[model samples]
Target: MFLLSTILYDKNHVLQNNILTTLRHVLSNITMAKNEKHSVKLRIWFYSGENKVLGKGRIELLERIKETGSISSAAKGMKMSYRQAWQMVEEMNEFSKLPLVEKQLGGKSGGGTKVTEAGERAIIAFHTLENKVNAFTVKEAEKLKF
Candidate 1:
């Protein structure tokens, strides 16, 4: 009876060890799968004299302004304050050679804003450069070792 009990204990110990090894193997595979499927995001911003000229966030603001036709409306749509949106527009206008946005005075018809030709051009150029940089980064990521 004693020998039979010792044999049963050894079988149970081996079974537990096998189960633990299988669990470890599964967890490591899951971790490796996660590590293998990853992406790189590139945010490109241009600056001049310690001031930001153009960046992803600013570009989104510009697009929002163009879409909404009012800085306040754009701000509301983005869940930002009117003052913050106005400040960003001011900074962009100050930095650029041409004013990117033009505001009309409020009257019976109400005031509205529009993006200048230069603003449109700037948006296009920014997106073009951004796309190029993102493509380059993706290629670089593909070449990464370890």
Candidate 2:
């Protein structure tokens, strides 16, 4: 009776360990499946010779400037320094055929910045290109196995 009881206890212990091991394997596979999925990341930049003329950050800055009508306000909204924002606008203006941002003189209502017609066109064109490129990337990403 004593030998039989000892054998039964050992068997139960082994069974518990095997069940635990299987559960761990299943959980690990589930975790891996969740984490192993892949996607494509792409960044688009328009350049002039060696200088970068436009990109996602610049586009956001332009949109913010258009919305807020002030370079300083736009910079603040984006958590960037006013000087940096000013430099970007200057570079964009210098690179483009026409000025992207224009400054208005102070008046009764106070002076502010404005996005020119050309700037509006540039913003739209960039967005259109970005969408097309993103679609292409997504379609290509689906073909990747690992």
Candidate 3:
């Protein structure tokens, strides 16, 4: 009777271990599937010769400037320095056919910045291109292997 009880205990312990192992495998696979389903994102930047024409970052900066009406404010919103923001605005204006950002000096109404018609068009075009590229990459990502 003692021997029989010991054998039964060993069998039960073995079954429990096997069940735990299977559960772990199932849970791991579930986690892996969740990770695998994550979507892919794409960013694009346009350039002419060696200078960056427009991209997500610059477009966003332009949008921010439009919203705040000040290069300094926009830089603050984006956590960038005023000088850096000024440099980017200068670069964009220099690279494009038309000046994208217009600055007004301090006066009765104080100073501010404005996005020109051409700048607005640039933002729209960049976003449109970004959307198309993102769609293409997402579709392509579905076929990629680990």
CA-only RMSD, every prediction: 10.1, 10.7, 10.4
lDDT of 1 at 56: 83
Deviation in Å, model 3, residue 9 alpha carbon: 45
Ranking by lDDT: 2, 3, 1
Cα lDDT, all candidates? 0.83, 0.87, 0.84
lDDT for predicted candidate 1 compared with the true structure: 0.83
Enumerate residue pairs that collide in model 1: none
Query: What would the per-residue lDDT of candidate 2 be over residues 1-146, giving only the tens digit for each residue?
Result: 53444456675577566556767777888888668756789999988888888999999999999999999899999999999999999999899888898987796468878999999999999999999999999998888867
TM-score of candidate 3 relative to the true fold: 0.69
Candidate 1 lDDT tens digits, 65-146: 8998988898898898889888988898888877889988796469978899999999999999999989999999989955
Pitting candidate 2 against candidate 3, the one with the higher lDDT is 2
lDDT of 2: 0.87
Q: Among these predicted structures, which one has the highest lDDT?
A: 2
Can you write out model 3's per-residue Cα lDDT over 27-85, one digit (the tens) per residue? Answer: 88888866666777767887777899787788989999999999989999999999998
Could you tell me every candidate's TM-score relative to the true structure? 0.71, 0.72, 0.69
